[model samples]
Target: MESAIRITRETEFYQGYIRFKMAVTNESPYAVNEVTLDFVYDDELLRVDRYEPLYVEKKGKLHLGSIDGGKSKSIAVYFDPQMCSKGTDIECNVAYKDYKGKRYIVQMEPKEISVICPIFRTVSDINTGRLKEILERLPHSESCVFEVLSSFDMFKLVNLSREVIEKRNVKHVRTLYTKDKTNYELWYYGKTKVNDDNIVIKLSFLAVQHTVELFAATQTAEALTGLLADVGKDLKVTIESRVTGKGRFNLHLINSKITGNTINNLLDQCNMDGTCDVNIVIDNINERTNAGRSSVNNTNFLNEQEEQRLEAEKQALIKIEQEKQESLQKEKAEKELLRKREEERLRKQREELGRIQAAEEPKRKEEEYARLKKEKERQEQLQKEKAEKELLRQREEEWLKKQKEKLEQIKTAEEAKIKQNEAQARLRMEQEMQERLQKEKAKQELLHKREKEKAEKQLKNKNASTCQKINSNNSKSNNKMLMFVVVFGILVLIVFFAIIPAASSSEQKAIDESVKGDNYYNQGNYDSALQAYDNAIELDVDNSTYYHSKGTALCGLGRYDESLDSYNKALDLDENYTAAWTGKGYALNELSRYDEALVAFDKAIEINSMDAQAWSGKSEALFKLGKYEEAQAAAEDALDVRSFG
Candidate 1:
């Protein structure tokens, strides 16, 4: 049944958008009902679009209604991409029901699609370590977010970033307090060229630290989604993910990307926290776009002097924090030592007390042994309870991990489904286009055949009925018709081939010399070409083409004066010889005779208006004369004539 339905997909690109056309056709004996195509789309990269002959039933799905046997329907849909992306799959499901009430879904093979963006490069994942190392060493303030920078001064770009932040609605802020606190800026930039479907871009992003407080707030998951939701509020974000054994902190930023569940991989390894959360896609501030520290200005949009002042302040603060951390470590170590000493002292006292009891109550030895056994059981029970709590915590962490994996799987599935409907629509449209073309071709052929038959009938007006013809004369007419066919074939062969003429021996020699000169000229052997053309001129001095050939050969040899003489001689033989006139113009131009060149070129143009060489020569002559406007017009004429030809 699937074989009974045929589909084809066609893709086209325009200046601002891409189009996918689909054609769905039924080759079955019976009609199908309620045919539908469904798929998912990433809103961030492409926006949903509609053109003529295409109507959507709903988002991510198209209701095709019904497909009759031997019928085809087509539609075109468009995509306007906002950012570059690594390739993602969008699966399509084609489901339909037969008149008999049986439903079927057509499965299609996966297909590869290509997209081209001028300046942006698409990457699957980012390596944050390298990006962070580069950013931390920036000489400027952290608030100087760069949007696009190679074309402008650094401060100006930073000013623009600051302006965006000021005008922007801060919307919401959510921070995760992690044990690790070394946060680095991330970005991408480019100077690139994408050829065909192959995209190549190079550039890094620049951003400020104003967006994050680093480790200040203890934001619950409820307060977190506001920013993530805005990321692709109008459209769905496309994600490129990988499976790793190194996953930690459900939402911690480990990979260059920060898609997290427990910690949603948003921050780097040092930013790890013991928790779970969803994810968001953040990139470098880049050509078009990135600060924050403790007790620091939220907006580090400072001037050079201010930046220096801030840096000095930051260094002082950093030193103080380091000393504070060292003191805390020392205090912790001393406390651990003191606790161990106290435990040893308590153990000694217990032993002494136990010995004293043994001597004082020798009869109570059985009671003492039972009491010791009970104490051992109590300690063992406490250990068992501690182990169970540890195991439970491990299970909870595992559960969070499983949930994150499930979400990723769901996203992957949805991605495939979205593209499925889009591809399906494209296939249906292609089928319709092909059918229209075929019908048009057949119609034209039939019209041609009918016209040909009409002409034949009009020419042969003496209509003799076969029944009225004598049977005895049929053999004679057949013999006559056969003879006519043979005669006609011979005439056709002669007519088609009669252009071949037998030249006299001297004329043939002249042509051979001219051909030899042409081959030499093509090979850039101007000295040899000149000799051959001279021989041809001696053999057939009256031929204008030979003189023109001699002129070109002389021109090639830097003999402009001689070339001019030869051109004049060719023109003398035939005044309307356009090539000789053009050659004369070229020779005159080379000699800096702009007036003479213009006259010669004009003469050539008068004889043949479509002569591009003459137009080009005229343009050069006018340009030499400083008639800029006239030269431009002549140049334009040459281009127009060549394009038509």
Candidate 2:
């Protein structure tokens, strides 16, 4: 039956498995049904593991169901590299039925499958003669070999070997060390299952050298070789032993008689140690002896043959001499007759040539003269065109010169205009700066006047309050006349006679200076307030109020440490000074001495429990100390006291 299907097969090697993909297209007019594909490969070299659509073990077949006309179907088969022997081919057979239930089977030509062991790929990459020799010596049918560079360490080589094996799906890898511990062995299965065939790889390290040797009993030598080569490339080292047969001589039998002794001598010359099969053509001893006798007799028979050969040569020379004499007589007769005929023909041709030349001479001269006249007119026209071109060139040069001059003048004008604009801009900027400065100066003067008036008003209020307190004290003294009249009369006589004038003079002046400092402090003039407070303290050094006022001015100036010292002095004069204690806490807080600040705040609270500022300062110190709970309580206390006030 005629075939109506086209099939294409492809094979690829990935890790240890060979993948076969077949694309089948139906070219018939009717749809094909029950399409099944069968893959046949050498069982010893390859074993089918799985396939697409449907996979049947042992049979290596896949059922593709059906395919429509002009449609295609693909099937893939994955198989393990069993032996990986060279020169092996894999066959594919496709069987299917058409819509009429007519069965047809197509057997495609066997495709040559190359199971390139990774090791062989690596050997190819190195392309070294030494490596190729080593690869040829390796048993390609059942074994593989690998050698690490002289610079590689054995420990790293072993680790890299395991990685290479694992990547190829080899499992249960275990290392074994030799008795001397100088050599190691790795045993693993070709597949993930333990029951599968195992590959035994022996590794040995060369002493006093940097090279490592690896030997394995497996069919996937190519895979191992490629892995080692890749590692060598990554390490920038060279692999010394890669087995290849590229340059080696491969013996083949030809149609020639070779004796056993000759074969032995040839083998000896090659120094071959391996077993080799030599095909020999057996012959009978009697037949060989008769042929030798026949060769000797034929030599004598050749002498007789030479005499007959000389006799034939003599006869041929005699015949050639007779023919030469006859040819010379015929040639002389023919030459005499041809010479007479040639002379007659030449005489007639010469007379005809003279007549033709005499007639054409005048016509030739007339054509020559006309040609010369046209040449003179052409030269004259060219001279006229050259003169006009020269005149046009001169005019163009003059026009360009005028254009250049105008462009230069315009450029100069633009540059001058830019300079004038820049000068005007600079002058306007200077005027604006002057105006801003004048406005700032006026604002400062107005601020100074307002501050002075505010300070004066505060000072007047302070003086009035002081006068009221003094009057209150005098009224109290008057009210206590009945109860301490005798004591008061005695004290009044002592103050009037011994202390009244001196106390009034020095203490009154100190109070006035203290008031002046208070005014300055209220006006936000801490530097002047500090100086005025210093004067008051000089006049009355024992006055705790004077020191307290000075500490306030110091705190306003951000001199927390100096402020603390002044507050301390105030406390020394009067330990119960609440304002001084609170100011000292604020100064300590500013100095980042949170613990000392808390203690000062506690003291102020003890002296005057209603002091809200002291409570707030204590809360701030607590917050700084990371005591969130205590800080919250203190803050609440501050709010309560503030609300009460």
User: Against the true structure, whose lDDT is highest?
Assistant: 2
Candidate 2 local lDDT, 57-159, one digit each (tens): 4444677878999999887777655333444667766888878555666877778875543322110111123222333443422222233322444544444
**Model 1 accuracy (lDDT, Cα):** 0.52
Candidate 1 lDDT for residue 272: 25
* Candidate 2 deviant stretches above 4 angstroms: 1-505
lDDT of each: 0.52, 0.56
| TM-score for each candidate, following the candidate numbering | 0.23, 0.29
lDDT of 1 by residue, 425-481 (tens): 434644554576567557656755765575456435323333355567776687568
Local distance difference test, candidate 2: 0.56
Single out the weakest 10-residue window by summed lDDT for candidate 1.
234-243
TM-score of candidate 1 relative to the true fold: 0.23
